[model samples]
Target: MECAAVSAPVSSHPPPSQINTSPEGKKPPEHLRRIIGEPPGPIVALLTRGVWALLTALSPAARDALARFVGNLAYTLGIRRKVALDNLAQAMPEKSEAERRAIARGAYITMARVVVESLPAGDRMTPDWDKQGIEGEEAWAALKAHVATGKGVLLATAHFGNWELVGQMLIRFGVPLNALVRPLKGALNTRIAENRLGAGAGLIYPKGAIQEITDAVNRGESAFMLLDQALPAKAAVFVPFFGRLASTTPAMAVAAERTGAPVFVVMGVRPPGPGARFRLEVEGPIPAPKPGEFADPITEHTARVTAALERAIRRHPEQWLWLHRRWKVQPPAALVTAPSPGLTSGPAPESAPKV
Candidate 1:
C-alpha cells in the first residue's frame, strides 16, 4: 500500500507499528534518532550558557574574522568544498570562468563568517531588517498583515544564509517565533541553543515539534522552519534545485496542509558591511492545495523556495553555507552534474573574482 503523499512526519513518539515488532525490525538511522527528542535540558542549558559567554567575550570584528578563518580552514581540509563548488557551478553556469571561481571564494569566506557570527554571545544584536534593502518588500508586508488576523504565520526557510539570525531578528521585533531545529551533539549544540534562546527565540525538535507548532498556530503563533537538508531515510521527495534533484522536506507543506496556515518563504542574506548586517526577505502566502489536488503542495512549495534560494545565493554567493552536503544523494545519470565552462567544479580556482 502507498503511504500518504507526505507521510506522518517522523516524530519522536513511538508508533503502534513498532509495538508488534521485534528488535530485528528496522531501526531508524543514528542521525534521525539522535534528533528525535526535545530541546536540551537544564544541564545542557548550563553548558550552552557557558559557550555563549565565551563567544560573547569576543569583539564583533573578532567573531566575524574567526568565522572567516574557519570557513577557509574547512576549504583547506576539503570539507564539503566539492558540494559547495558543485552547487555554485550549477547556479551560475553562465558566468566567466574567473567569475565563477571568485564567487566560490567569496562563498567560502561568507560561509565561515556566517558560522562564526552564529556562535553564542552573551547578547544578540537587533538590526533593523529594513536597512538590509530586501527586494521583495510586498511579500513581507502581506505576511505582517496576517499578524492582525491572529492566525500564526509559518516562515519556511532553508540552510541558505544565517538562518538562526532570522529567528533572532523576529524575536527582537517581539514576534513570537519557535524555530524547528535539529540538536547538535555535545557541548557545541548546547551553547548555540542557549544563545539563541537568550536572544528571544524558542527551539523545538522535529520529534515532538509538530504538535507544539500546530497548537501555537491554532492559538495564533508564528513559526519558522529550515527545509533544506537531505534526510535519505525519512520520508522525503526529490525536488529540482540548481537543475539537480535535491531531497526536499515535506514538513512545510504538511504543516500548511494540516493547519490551513498561510506559508511564507523567508530567508536572510548577509549585507556588504564592516560587520554582519542581514536582509530578511519574505515571499508568498505560498499557494496551498485547493479542494482536490492529489499530489502534495509541498513539492510545489519546495520548488518555489528552492528557486528563491538559488536566486539569493547567486546574488550573494559569499553569504551562503557551502560546507553542508546539500546534494549528498545524487540522482540518476540523466541529471546534470558535470561542470560547464566558466563554471568549474569544486571550490574557486584560487584567483576568481567575487560575484
Candidate 2:
C-alpha cells in the first residue's frame, strides 16, 4: 500500500491564499508580526507550534501515550464531559454507566490523537497504508468503477476515527479527491489548507461550495463530504441514527441523485493497541435509487447513507465523535405528525439540551 508509485498531484485549482493578515488593511508592528505572525495571539501561536513540534518529535507510541494523557485530563476536567455522556446515554442505553464512561474517555482519547496525528506536516501526512493495514480493495475497486463511468464519485464520510487519514489514503490511491471542509480561524486555517493541498487533495470551502462540488464531479473528480454533522432543520433531512432521528445534511444524496454518481461511505478505524495504525473501512457505492423508489429518493438516500455511517460507528462507538450535538435539531410538531419531503416519519425526541 506504499504510494511510492503515486505521483504528486498537479492540480489546476489555485492554492488557498493566506487570509491571516491584519484586518484594517494595515500591517502589524514589525516585532509583533515577526513573533505572533497573525490574528491568533503570540502565546497561542507559540503554544500551537510548540505542541506540534513536541508531538512530531516523539515516537509513535510516545505520541499516542501523550495524547491519551491529554484526553484523560480533559475528561477529568469535564470538558464537554456532559455532552459526551448524554450522547452515549441516548445512543447506547444497552450499555451500563461504567461502560459508557469508559467509552467517553476513549472518545476523548481518539479526538486528542486525531488532532496530534493531523499536526504533522508534508510527507508525514501520508500514512504507510501497509503499516496501517488498511483493507480497502473492494472500496478501491468501487471507486475505480465509479470514476470509470466519468460521472464522478461521492465519498460520504464522518468525524469517525482518523477521518483525515481516509482522504490521504484516497489521494495515495491516485484518486483525484476534493473535500468540503469548514475553514478554521486565523493562521490555523491557512496551515491546514496548505497541508491538505500539500497532501494532493483539493479543499472545497462549505460556503457556496455546491456549484463547485457539482462542477468538480462533472469533470470526473471525486468529492468527499462529511455527512454526520448536525445542520439546521431547513437544510437537513431527518434520518434515523441510533434509534433517534438526527438532522442530517442530504448534500451527498442530492448530489448522487442529481449527477448519477455513486455514493460510498468511507471511514478509518483505530484498532486497540499502542500506536496502532488505523484500518480503512469503505462501504458502498451504496445502491442508487431507482425511479419512484417509494417516495422522496433524496430523503431515502440520505437515510441509507446515514445508516451506513451508524453501522460503522456502532462497531467502534468510542472512535466516533460523541461530543458533538448530533441530535440537536428535532422536527417541528406539524412535520412530526405529517412528515414532509426529505423527512422520515418519527416522533421527534426532545431537542438536545444546549451545551
Candidate 3:
C-alpha cells in the first residue's frame, strides 16, 4: 500500500497557528477558523491565466495527454497526496488505508482526464453518457415537468464526478441550462468561460450572480451551481459530513426557498470499464425546506447537498477531488456541529489513521 508524501500532521506538530492569540484582538474559535477564507488573489490569478493560455494553445491530443501526465505526476510526488487520502479515510471509515490510498490516486488521475475531456466542443466531445453508464431518465423527467409548468429549475452539483458534462448532456437530452460560475482569475477564466459557453449553456458570474439566478427562475430557465466548496464565515453552516463537521454554503437551499423551483442534484460518474469512460447520474428534488423556513436556505440546502456528496464519495471513493484544500479553515459557533468524540478541540487532524 503506497501513499504519497504530505506535510506533517497539524496535530503531531502544530504549523504556525493561523489564528491571532492576542487578548486585545479576539481570537477566532477552532470552528470559525475553517469556515471563513478567500479564494486565490491577483498573483494566483496571473498564474492561472498563464496556465489557461498554455493549455488552450495546445492541440486537443496534447491537452488530453498533458492532463494524464499531470495526474500521474501528482501521484508520484505526493503533493496534497495526504489531503486526498485523509479525506478518503474520513469518507470511508470502514475501508483499509491501502484501499483508501488506491482510491485517492485513481481520483486524481480521473480528474486530470476530466479537465482535458471538457476542453472539446459539445459536438467534438466523445464518450457519450449512454455509452459511459449515464442513466438520466429521472432527471430528464424532472426537467420536463418543471419546463412544462414554466417555473424554472435549479440543478445543484459538486466537484465530484465529471460535472463538466452536465451542460452538454442537458443540451443533447433536450434540457438547456444556465450555469452559475465563479469567474476565474485571468486567461484561464476567459478560456473556461468560452469553452463552457461553447457547449450552448448560459453562464452567470458568481460575484453578482444572485440577480441573474432570480431572473432565470422568473423567466423559467434552469440553473446549475457547484455547491460543495467551503464558504465564508458569515455564509457557512457546519454540517455532519463523513462523521466530521464541515462548513458548507446554503445557496442551493436559499435558491429553492426563493424561486419555488424544483431542485435536481446531478453528478457525472466514471463507469467501471476500460480506458476512462464516464457516466452522468441525476438524483432527487431531495426535499427542500418546507413552506415556512426561509431565513437561511444556503445553510439548509448546503447541508442536504453535503450529505448527498458524502454518499457519492463513499460509493466512488477514488473519483472525488482530494488535492484541493477543501477543509483549509474551520466554521464559527453558529456553524459548528456537536464535536465528535476523538476529534480534539484545537485543530483538525492533519493525518487520519487508516481503519
Candidate 4:
C-alpha cells in the first residue's frame, strides 16, 4: 500500500548561506604509489561482478542461507571478531557475555547479507512495496510533511540494516535523494556510482560536496549521508552514543541550520526469517536549535540526532555495523570536564522507549 498522499504548495527558495563543508583531508598526490598488497581496481571490479552474478542467480532464500554460512564462517575464524566483540562490550555492558556473543554472530550474518543485497544486480532484488514492505506511519508522515514544504530535507542515516535499500525505497515513494559517499578505489567507485544512478538516486562525493548539497536542498531535493562513522577530533563534535562520548560529524546539523532544512533519521530493517522483506523506519525533523537555545547549537543538534540513532540501534542491535571502532576518538580532558550545556555525559537509562 502507498503512503497517505501529502500536499503542500511549493515555496520560494531561501537565499543561500555560506556552506559548511565536511572536514575531509586533501587528496594524496597522484605520484604516490599504491600500497602493496592492494589489487588493481579493474580486477577487483571483475571479481565483484562475478560474485554478484552468482548471488543474483540464487533464490532469495538460498542467497540468505549462503550469507548465513559466510557469516558463521567469518565469526568462527575470528575475522575482525575481536573488534566487533569489543565494540559490543563497550556499547552494551549491561548484557551478559553470552548475549553479546549472540548479537555479534547475528551482526556478522547481517553484514554478509547487506554486502550481497547492496551489490548492483539489476532489478532482481528491487523491493516490491505492495507485497513485501512495512512503513512506520508516524515517521513516514513526518518525512512526507517535510518534503511537502518544498525545502529539501537532510537525511541522517547509519550503516545499520540495508542502508542502500532505503534510498531506493524513497525513490519508489517519489522522493528524490542525493547521497554523499566516500569514493572507493578505482573501477569499484565507478560501478557504485552507476548503481546508485541506475536506482534513481544522485551521487555527491565528499571532497567538494558541500556547495552541491546546499544547492540541491535549496532547490527542494533531499541529501542523504551516514552519520555513524568516526571523525578526527578536530573535525568532530563529542556526542553521547551508547553511553560513551563519541566523535560525530556535525555536517548535517550545520547544513540544516544554514539552509533551513529539517533533519530526519531513516533506516531499513530486515525482519527474521528467510527471504524477509525490509521495514523502513524514519525518525525526525529531529528538533532544531531555537534562537539562543544554547551556547553551541551545532553540538546540541548533533547530540540529538546521535541519540536518535542510538535508540534505533538499540531496537535491533544485531543489524548495526559493530565491526568498526565507533568510539576510537576521545575528547580532551578540558572539553570532557566542561561539557556543553544540554549535552548529557551519562549513559541513557535502559528504559528509554524504542523507536
After the best TM-score superposition of candidate 3, give how far the Cα of residue 274 lies from its true spot, in angstroms.
6.1
Supply the TM-score for candidate 2.
0.80
Cand. 1 Cα-lDDT: 0.59
Q: How accurate is candidate 4 locally (lDDT)?
A: 0.69
Q: TM-score, each model? A: 0.74, 0.80, 0.72, 0.83
Q: Tens-digit lDDT track for model 3 on 1-355?
A: 0000001211132112311111122221222122112345678867776665665566655765777688888888988888887777666778888887788778787777766655443233443334554445555465567765755687877676566665555544445456766545443345445555555556665555566667777765667777667667567666666766666666666677777677776676766543334566565666665555644445555566666666656667667777666675586654454432222222212111111
The better candidate by TM-score, 2 or 4, is 4
Error of 3 at 222 (Å): 1.0
Q: Give the TM-score ranking, best first.
A: 4, 2, 1, 3
Instruction: Compose the digit string of candidate 4's lDDT tens values, residues 122-235.
Output: 653433332444445565676787766765788887888777766655655546667776645454445445556656566665555677678878766688888888889999
Query: Which parts of model 2 are misplaced by more than 4 Å?
Result: 1-43, 125-128, 131-139, 148-151, 186-190, 338-355
| Per-model root-mean-square deviation over C-alphas | 12.8, 9.7, 15.6, 9.0
True-vs-predicted CA distance for residue 213, candidate 2, Å: 1.6
The TM-score of predicted model 1 comes to: 0.74
Assess candidate 4 and give its TM-score to the true structure.
0.83
